[model samples]
Target: MIDCGRAKRPGWSPSVHYAGTAIDLLVIQNLDEDHVEDLSELLRTVTVRSVFSNPTVTASALASMKPDGMRTGVSTAHNVLRDFGPGLIGRWPDTGEVQVVHFYCRFGTHFTETNDLSLATFFRWGNFTILFGGDLETAGWQMMLRNQEFQRLLVGTQVFVTSHHGRENGKCAELFQIMRPDIAVISDDAIQYGTQEKSTQWYRDKVKGIPVLGTENAYGIRDKRHVLTTRRDGTISIAVGAWGNYLVTPEKVQNELTLGEILGAFGRNALSKDSQVA
Candidate 1:
């Protein structure tokens, strides 16, 4: 799981619905509260094998997981490119092997805070390259563009994860020119930390003819209806095959079953008739 969290605005832990689930690896791209809320509680529920992130101001936040029988490490720029560089990360259940290309500004760069130190990762499964920009902002993007090692990883990128929750300051038109992604995914909410109008407009004009997908509805944007939001479209899933062929689907969340409906179903069952009478 990458950046396990809900927004830090209201500051609520995730529901217990995932109590029995197991997380093999947890990738904390940024240590921002919004990206890492409920991490303590999350550790209590699921068993995480390892945690990876860039060494940054807030990288120490992951220390809690170490005592929970989990291995955690912060990657330096040289360490990333040398060790976890453009190579096989893992293979999907029924698809091609996934390769991750890592890049960070640990040496000389403009980044001094957590967001800028966020690891810029390129995940490639076959020919489908999905760039996970973390929360990298303008300066960070510029830094990556200058790094020759990072440039080598940007080849054939088609899907982009919008940096800094699609905020205006995170916009990097030059980076977009290099990637030329078909779709940009924004992990943000409708109210706080939402995608900015300027960012969306810039992408539309720069990229041209690509859908900007957001996890929540963002206000003050043109062609509002065309912008795909999770609030309306539900969870979006992209499946890629061994050959790099892909399919994108929006899994709409259905309404929860009412108590009355449950009772009606139980009553209709012959097996429950005796129990009801008893």
Candidate 2:
């Protein structure tokens, strides 16, 4: 998993269910408490072969240094490029099922927050590609776009997880242009950020009427297929298969019949039977 939420959320904890399983690559995009809450507990419980994080900032390192002037926690983080580059992690020989996990971690000289240090990653197999922007904002995206290598990697992205929870500051028109995504997902709570209208426009303008799906539907329904939110739909899962075929399953609603409706149905049935008999 890329990131784990803080233990504060109601009825959600990875440690309870996933602690015993082996985690091949635990990539901590940003080590800020919010991004990495309960990570220490997670590391203690789970068997992680390796962990990848951005280079430790000078300020964070200095602040964390002990009074004896010994630097600790140095062994926990490995630079992304050194650890995992653009390549295939594994493949099934018979069916040719492949796993393509790529990492793009870049930062400018003068950093302030962990968000600036987020890593951009993507997973691809067959003809489907899903891009995870890792909470990257305007400045971080601008820096990444400057690199021609990054642009080449972003083309033909089928799905895009919007950066920084679909906030306006995270909007990078160039990134959307490069990805040309069919659908975009925003991982934000309802009204936690601004209106989805702005976020929708960001990608629609670039890809020509592309749908921007948010985790929360603060605004009313625009189009059932275009603008969808998880608040109403609950959990959304997408299954991708060969030749770029994929299926998305959204939450369903159950219908219950009232007594009046049941009686009305019986009356209509009786009338139909009488007409037939006559």
RMSD of 2: 11.6
Q: Pick the candidate with the highest lDDT.
A: 1
Each prediction's Cα RMSD?
A: 12.9, 11.6
Off by over 4 Å in 1: 7-17, 56-96, 107-110, 193-195, 208-227, 252-278
- lDDT, model 1: 0.56
TM-score of each: 0.66, 0.66
lDDT for 157 in candidate 1 is 67
Residue clash pairs of candidate 2: none
Which lDDT tens digits does candidate 2 get at residues 1-278? Answer: 76655433245556665878867766666545445555656667787665555544433342343234321222222122224432222231221464544444433354555576677777778677777777778888887887886787689676777777667877887776677766666655555555565776665555422222222266632232433345444445665644564544444321233445433433433423111000
Residue-wise C-alpha lDDT for candidate 1, range 1-278, written one tens digit per residue: 67766643344344244676866556667755556655766767776565566643332333322244322222221233244432222332222367766677652235556677788877877667877778888888898899876766665765677888778888887785566655666666664544575566566554423322222246623232223334335555665544554444444412343445434433443232112100
lDDT of each model, Cα atoms only?
A: 0.56, 0.54
Candidate 2, residue 61: lDDT? 42
